[model samples]
Target: MGQAIVVTSGKGGVGKTTTSANLGTALALLGHKVCMVDTDIGLRNLDVVMGLENRIVYDLVDVIEGRCRLEQALIKDKRFESLYLLPAAQTKDKDDVKPEQVKEIIGRIKQLFDFAIIDCPAGIEQGFRNAISGADRAIVVTTPEKSAVRDADRVIGKLHSEQIEEPKLVVNRIRPNMLKTGDMLSIDDICSVLQIDVIGIIPDDDYVIKASNNGEPIVINPQSKAALAYRNIARRILGDPVPLMSLEEKPGFVERIKKFFKLG
Candidate 1:
């Protein structure tokens, strides 16, 4: 049986989608049968990130409603034989999905794949509930900013209430120099507050944006530090003991400003 993981963040713009895309790709690279599902409903972008948008004729809605079979909706990636994507319907709203429906879909997918990665929408609403409904575990992605961390804390609390055990953490968009200069939160700080094991720590690397714009996830590219972080994360998910990346000096104000607008 496969493990279903929901990658979520309480706040938007915290790299939940990017993490899902790269992690799914990374796991496939490691030889696992992985199917990533975009549960964002109306705001479907995981297909775009995975560069499989043009290939998506059917989506999760199509399978849930019996308009298409599960295999028909799955878009296989060329880079990895085991990698596949189940995109969300761009026309449907979050309310169009229910927790029970998500559970059923995940149950079916688990029968064939080794991992089911759910790209959860931001916030603690119905969409969030739908995303985590059938998840055997979860990875909460958050940035180093105060608001993002606060929202992550809220998410952790909600997960506890739902009885989801030991949800792992993925601290994304970290700027090491900013942490040294007291401009951003450190990994230790975020972990201390969240009180969970850190599964991954990805730096705020500019290469991620370039890779996204090219419609290629960084995990497939060997030159990206962020990609290396994600690769290590995939290994960790498979119970490998890999060393964590260290945060170092960050770029200056001009470079930092330039990095903010880059899409990743």
Candidate 2:
């Protein structure tokens, strides 16, 4: 059976859905059959981010409510043939589906895909519980800030209490220059507080905004720093020992030449 991993954050606006869309896309690029499930219900946006909004004839609610078959509800990606999206219902509330129902839906689809990535709703509520109910692993997305880290810690605690052990962390929207200038928390600082292994570190990049607005994931943009980071994260998920990208500003040609010549 495929792994069902939930991409979640305790607080909203921390790039949980973006991470889900990009990571699912990246994994598919690596030859894995991936499906991204949006469990945010009424506030769903994964379909839009994946550019499959208009193609969604049926959604998660439709599958659970028996209005459509499981295969009929899956919207295949236009770019990658292996990537699919199970969008949440925009017209329904979170209570439309219960946790057991979510688990049953995921269980049925897990056999057909290599990975099932659930884009969880923000906060600790019915939506959150339903999103994680069938997940085999959990990926907690957070920013390198006090509030985000604190909320992540709380979410991690709740995950463990619910028997979802050893949830990994992904720190998003990190500014290396801000960290150097003591204006933001470092990755080490956030990891120290959350006490979880860091699986990914996404840098703050304008390309992310442009790609999302254009209905494309940044992971497909080769020039984007955030894209590179996310691709590395995908490799890590598949047990590759890829080093974290150097977030510091790259050295100029002059500096590189000077270093090559052993001169200051």
Candidate 3:
């Protein structure tokens, strides 16, 4: 049976949607049948991030309400054959979805895809619970700021309460330079507080915004560092032993030279 994974963050604007979109695309590229569900309800953006906003005719709300078949609600990606998207209804409210309905839908999709990745809404409310109810695994996305870290801790607690064990952490928008200068929290710092295994570390790359604007996920670009991070996270999810990427804390050509040598 395929696993249902929920990509979530307690705080808003922590790159949860971006990570979900890219991870789904990366998993599809890795030859896995992947279905990404946007469970943000009314504030849907995964459709736009995956570049399928205009193609969405039927959405999650429609499927649960029996307005359309699951296949009809699913939008296939243009670039990856194994990739699909189940967008949320922007016209509906969060209360439109019940936790049981979301679980049933994900359970149905699990049989058809290798991975069902749910892009959870921010906060620990009804939308969040609905998104994570069916997930076998959970990935918490957070930044280095104090508020984000605090929210991550709360999320970990909630996951445990929900019987979701060891939900992995993904520290997004990390600036190595800031970390080195003591201006930001390092990966170690974040992990130390969260007390969970670090599954991915994504840098703050300008390419991410550029790719989002163009309606293409950075993971498809291949040349982007953030894309590489997302791909590594996918491999990790699949039980591959890819080494983690180094976040540049100190600004200089010395570390760059060392990184180059290591790559070579």
Candidate closest to the true structure, highest TM-score: 2
The residue-by-residue lDDT of candidate 2 on 1-264, one tens digit each, is 899999998999999999999999999999999999999999999998888899989999999999999999999999999999999999999988899999999998799999999999999999999999999999999998899898899899989988999999999999988999989999988887889898999999999988998899999999999999999999999999998888888999998998989964
lDDT-best of 1 and 3: 3
Query: What stretches of model 2 exceed 4 Å from their correct place?
Result: 254-264
Better of 2 and 3 by TM-score: 2
lDDT at 83, model 1: 94
Locate the minimum summed-lDDT window of 10 residues in model 1.
255-264
The residue pairs in collision within model 3 are 176-248, 176-249
Candidate 3: RMSD to truth: 3.2
What's model 1's overall lDDT?
Answer: 0.91
Where does the lowest 10-residue lDDT sum fall in candidate 3? Answer: 246-255
- What ranges in model 3 sit over 4 Å off? 249-264
lDDT on C-alpha atoms for all candidate structures: 0.91, 0.94, 0.94
Candidate 1 C-alpha lDDT tens digits along 140-200: 9999988999999999999888888899999998877788788788888888899999999
Q: TM-score-based ranking, best first?
A: 2, 3, 1
Q: Candidate 3: global Cα-lDDT?
A: 0.94
CA lDDT for candidate 2: 0.94
Residue by residue across 179-245, what tens digits does model 3's lDDT show?
8789998888888899999999999999999999888999988778899999999999999988899
